[model samples]
Every structure is written in structure tokens, then in C-alpha cells.
Target: MSKIMSAPTLHHFSSLFTLFIVLLHHSNADVGTASRYSPPYLPSGCYGTEATQFPSSNLFAAAGDGIWDNGAACGRQYLVRCISAEQPRTCIPDQSIQIKIVDYAATAVSPASAGGTTMVLSDKAFGTIANMSATLINIELQQV
Candidate 1:
């Protein structure tokens, strides 16, 4: 004789299966998607120069210990991409912005306060990649 599952039991199992499928899809998607790093910020002070002197259309980011490259990293460049963002907004997919390191941020002003973000973008830089007004956004950083 075969035993029949109760209605409630069947419903519960269905819900679990749906959840499993969703989780599996997300996990597989993650494999092809670039991971996003958090705690991004827009620095108040950068190189003590006028903003106009900097490349407005291009992207720019702040560095932490990496900036202490004995002035070597001062002019280094990188390719930045918005991978994810907090609620009310999401990263602009596959958008790559080239940026340069123009400033240095202390650990105090880095990740912890900025949500553990190692790179800080300038206002113009952030605006180009994000449509929101938030000061922080997740990004993919690559040295160039």
C-alpha cells in the first residue's frame, strides 16, 4: 500500500522546492558574474587640487595602504565596473569605467566607515556609473 502525503505537507514541500530552484539559479549566475566589493565612498579631499583639473568624464578612486606605494601609485590607473548596489538601486551591468588613483584615504576613513570598500570614487566618477544619490556602491576594481 502507498501512503499519501497530507495537503499541508505537499504545500510545504512545493515551497521548499521553489526556494531551492531560486537559490540554485542565483548560485550559478554568481559564477559568471563578477563579485562586488562594498563600502565605496566619495572623497571630500583629493590631491588638494581643483576638481576641474581632474578628468570629469573618466573615473577616479581613492587608495588606502595601496596608495603608500612611495608615490608610485599616485598616477596608477584602473578599470572600474559597477557590479552591485544597495536597495533602491542596482549596479549598471557590464559598464566599465576607467579611473585613476588621485588621492589617498586613511584606514580610519576607508572600509570601516565606507562599508569595507577599498576604493573611493570621486563624485563625477560615481555619477557616471550610478544613477542614485547614495555615497557608497559596490564595484569591481582592476589595475590597468
Candidate 2:
């Protein structure tokens, strides 16, 4: 009868929906775990250098300017030079923060003119500690 056939279809649809939900849940869990650990993509024995120059624009913004949306999470650990608007001419304070490298420029420009390497930070990381909008900071890679 039609009712009997409809019952089998309903059961099949429900089972598929359950499977989809399980897959979605599993994928989310995997992403959460992955964030806690550094990606394996960084090669062994690779180390970043300290920046002697600073760029003209906010380092964080410059770094993120041309990157994809995924760049929001791109920061890594960095040793940086921080300067306040009160003392713009000389950058005296030194700090360390984890920043994501968002842009790759063959030549350096703005905030501070780092030779060839540059990086950006998440809005939270940039704003909270470095004060990215008005403060200038120089970031260098930290050896792992």
C-alpha cells in the first residue's frame, strides 16, 4: 500500500539526516582540536629573523590587507618592538606576541620598513596588547 512505501522513505530520510549531523559534529570537533596545536606545515629547523625596520601602516592591517578571510587566525609567535604615539621617533619598548603573517611582500613598506618579511595579527591580538591602530610594533619570528 502507499502508506507502507511512505514509511520506508521516511525512515531512509531520517537515517541520512542523522548521518549528516554526525559528520558535521565530527568535523567541528576536529577543527577545535587542530587549533590548539600548531600546524605541522612549518618545516623543522626553520627560524624567523628579528626585524630591524618597521612599516608605515599598522603592521597588523598591512599584513591582513590582501589575505583571504581565513587570515583571521593566521598569527604565530613573534618578538616585537613596540612604540607609543607619545614617543614616535624612537621605538624603545620590546615585547613578544603571537601574530599571524598575512601578507608576503618582496619589498617592505610602512609603519616600519622591514626588509622582506612582514606579518599581521588578529584584531583581538592586535588591538588588545599592541594597540595596532595608533601604536607601532616590529615583529620577528620566534624559534620553536
Identify the candidate with maximal lDDT. 1
lDDT of 1 by residue, 6-35 (tens): 999999999999999988873211101121
Q: What 10-residue stretch in candidate 2 is worst by lDDT?
A: 28-37
Assess the local accuracy of residue 76 in candidate 1 as a C-alpha lDDT between 0 and 100. Answer: 72
Tens-digit lDDT string for candidate 2 (3-122)? 454888999999999999988873211000000111121221112233322232333322322332344423333333333334353333464444434332221232222222233333
Runs in model 2 lying further than 4 Å from the true structure:
1-95, 100-117
RMSD (Cα, Å) of model 1: 10.1
Question: Global lDDT of each model?
Answer: 0.56, 0.34
After superposition, the stretches of candidate 1 with alpha carbons farther than 4 Å from their true spots are 1-53, 56-58, 66-70, 107-116
State TM-scores per candidate.
Answer: 0.53, 0.26
lDDT of 2: 0.34
Cand. 1 Cα-lDDT: 0.56
> Residue 53 deviation, candidate 1, in Å?
5.6
